[model samples]
Target: MTQHLTIVDHPLVQHKLTIMRDKTTSTAGFRRLLREISLLLAYEVTRELEMTTTTIETPMQTMEAPTLEGKKLALISILRAGNGLMDGILEMIPGARVGFVGMYRDPETLQPVQYYCKVPNELDARMTIVVDPMLATGNSSVAAIDLLKKQGARNLRFLCLLATPEGVARMLEAHPDVPIVTAALDAGLDDHGYILPGLGDAGDRMFGTK
Candidate 1:
């Protein structure tokens, strides 16, 4: 595995991920699992955030305590599936700013085409975490990062519920600077661009659309 990719193997994350992968799991259950898993994943992803000591008066006495330093974190969700992960992460970091990037696959070229892109102010100043549920081909993921880099997002990290080996390779080759945090990395992608033995279409499963 590449150093840039961090596969979290916490028990809670694994448990919820397995439940989300089960075909018999209900839509509501799946959504709840994703949210639960996101909280654990967010904790791992944000572990390296900078902190500084600040003086504050406690109930007993005044004391200096560690607090998050610098600008507020920014989360850029690659919708619409990314929104599912984003919601739970937001719950964990309520003060963090939110952004959205929308892209749809171009059937003819099998490439991602941007339909929307919106980020908060001073993206360059804040550490940006791009959230998506799956990393299959890595085309969209790469494209999204390209756009963010163009907009001056330097310190970036990618958070996904699952990934495939092929997708990890693609991402490593294209955007090595952006570290990836995922719960599981499956065998590889299937014929139709789905992760094999992976939780079905995350968007459909999450929204109960299919």
Candidate 2:
């Protein structure tokens, strides 16, 4: 099956992305925009969530209404920058279970090394969504998915604010089962593995500490 990669080009998301991309945007503004755009993207990502009917009583009469079905969704944030997106998604789906994965690159091997991992209970039963602001080289994202798979999370999706073609290709090649939901796919990656014409270091910009 072809891995689904959705590039949400919603006007609100695009407008906020542009504002966040401006070098002069303040840290506060960046954080706010990230949250706003994340919410918009989250709405798109969860559009296909399964729903069931539930009886509800209205003033006029009782009727069945649509409600989320099965297990509650899980949101796993690939730490630091991912946390920024996580916060906004949480606002939209407050009941979603939360998980964290921390990966750092090894200078010698240029590979991801997981330093931390903690996921919610019964991951296999839930639809897990991994949130990260930027998909640069896809090393950390791949590593994070590896860890999740090891933890028994079979149904998984990755959500990001920005993605590079290289990163999308890498993720597809590495893990074809996982779908990627992103706000925008920029041109490509730079020599240093940074997304071209992309907002600079997400974590640094969100935290105001380049």
Model 2: CA > 4 A from native: 1-3, 107-109
> Could you report the Cα RMSD, in angstroms, for every candidate shown?
1.2, 1.7
lDDT of 2 by residue, 1-210 (tens): 134788898888889999998989999999999999999999878887889999999999999999999899999999889999999999989999999999866656557888888899899988999999999889999999989998999899999999988888899999989899998889987766678899998999999896
lDDT of each: 0.92, 0.90
Clashing pairs in 1: none
TM-score of 1: 0.96
Cα deviation at 58, candidate 2, in Å, is 0.9
Which residue pairs clash in candidate 2? Answer: none
Q: Which candidate has the highest lDDT of all?
A: 1
Error of 2 at 56 (Å): 0.9
> What's the TM-score of each model vs. the native?
0.96, 0.96
- Deviation in Å, model 1, residue 181 alpha carbon: 0.3
